[model samples]
Target: MQLSSLRAIGISKSFGAVAVLDRVDLAVHPGETYALLGPSGCGKSTLLRVMAGFETADEGRVELAGRVVRRPSPERGMVAQAGTLFPWLSLRDNLAFGPRESGRGDTEEIVAGLLEATGLTEFADALPRQLSGGMRQRAAIAQVLANAPPVLLLDEPFGALDAQTRLRMHEWLRSVLAARETTTLLVTHDVDEALLLADRLGLLSARPARLVEEIPVPFGGARGRHTLSDPAFVRMKAQILDRVMVA
Candidate 1:
């Protein structure tokens, strides 16, 4: 499978006279996940918003699968930190909304499977208010998957959860993405989260952000940051942490 280019070339974004990002370039190949890690005000979320088309880049371009994704199209979907679901809608209804809106031939069965996969089937009829934080977030992600987006832009998707829940969600996300191998770009401030979930990690400098470093996570039996017990993993984490804190 030739995973297409999900590239951000010399991307820059500004709000009026204040700039958030400058000349930041990101390239995530098909089936690979890249975590964008930086401290607060470093433009991680801003970059994600631009990639999701919620904010337009002031300069540079975004290209997907050889074509420029001009605006917020369903080909791309976002999972926000808040899991911004419709409070009044039931989980099943929320999943139905996207496919139904797109006229994509009734995704009922697909939605059912996704709900089950995300462990939300029992809560399908529950409103967002009735679900736990993790469940609601899972539903939000499932809702996006219903549309079958080729690329997923996750902006601190699990940042709001408790530490235990956040780690569990990372484990769950790995299982979910395994089947599809969907290209993903996740923006996160937590170093451990990035190390655990990403195939590669990119570090950025503070506001008027620029790419500073890229690290490829090793694939092995090491689970959690406990994997840092390995000498190589320990060195990698220390190196990335040093760059992050110093930046």
Candidate 2:
């Protein structure tokens, strides 16, 4: 299978002479969830911004399904760390916001379907303040999904939730992504989350981010995530830790 990959070739970025990414190469195959795992202050989020077309890379190019992603696009949807929702707008309206902003004609149907898909149907009329942490993120995700992007960029999407809620949301998101056959690139530091959700894991170094290591996660399907707790999984985690720490 070709995997309908998303790719970054010889990517590099710098901030006022501080090089963050040093000619990094990355690829996330279709239907495969990839995790960019690294320490805080590492360039994971910045790299994601570059991938999202929010920040232009000084040197590099991004391609999705062989087409260049030249600008910030609804085609590369994003769910950020913070809840990026309108306080005054109801959940339903928020979901419809993206499509409406894009001038898509069928906003109602699109929003309705996404709200239901993300299990927000009952909370459709609720404001951002009325929703729980998980719900807020879910709404943010729904808002992005309403645009029906081929590639989804998630930056610590479930990090705001409580531990229990985060675990539950992880399970739900894994199922949702698999069901939709969505191609995703998720930025997360949680080893368990990376092992559970990612098809492959990319480990990055601090300050100047480089591909310290790349490991195939072997989590082929949502149901396969549990295998991450096995002995083989522990060894893999150890290997990734070694790479991150040494780099």
**Evaluated with TM-score, which candidate comes out highest?**
1
lDDT of 1 by residue, 1-247 (tens): 3455598989998888888999999999898888999878889998988888888898998999978876897777899999968888989989988999988775788788888898888888988999989888888988888888889899999888999898888888877777778889999988777777789999999888999988888854235645537677677778888898877
Among all candidates shown, the one with the greatest lDDT: 1
Candidate 1 deviant stretches above 4 angstroms: 220-231
Could you estimate the TM-score for every candidate?
Answer: 0.94, 0.92
lDDT of each: 0.85, 0.84
Model 1 weakest lDDT span, ten residues long: 219-228
Q: lDDT per residue, candidate 2, 157-246, as tens digits?
A: 888778778877788788878776678999987777788787888988887888777888774564444665688878978877777666
Q: Give the count of colliding residue pairs in each prediction.
A: 0, 0
Worst 10 residues of 2 by lDDT: 219-228
Off by over 4 Å in 2: 1-4, 224-229
Model 1 lDDT, residue 90, Cα? 88
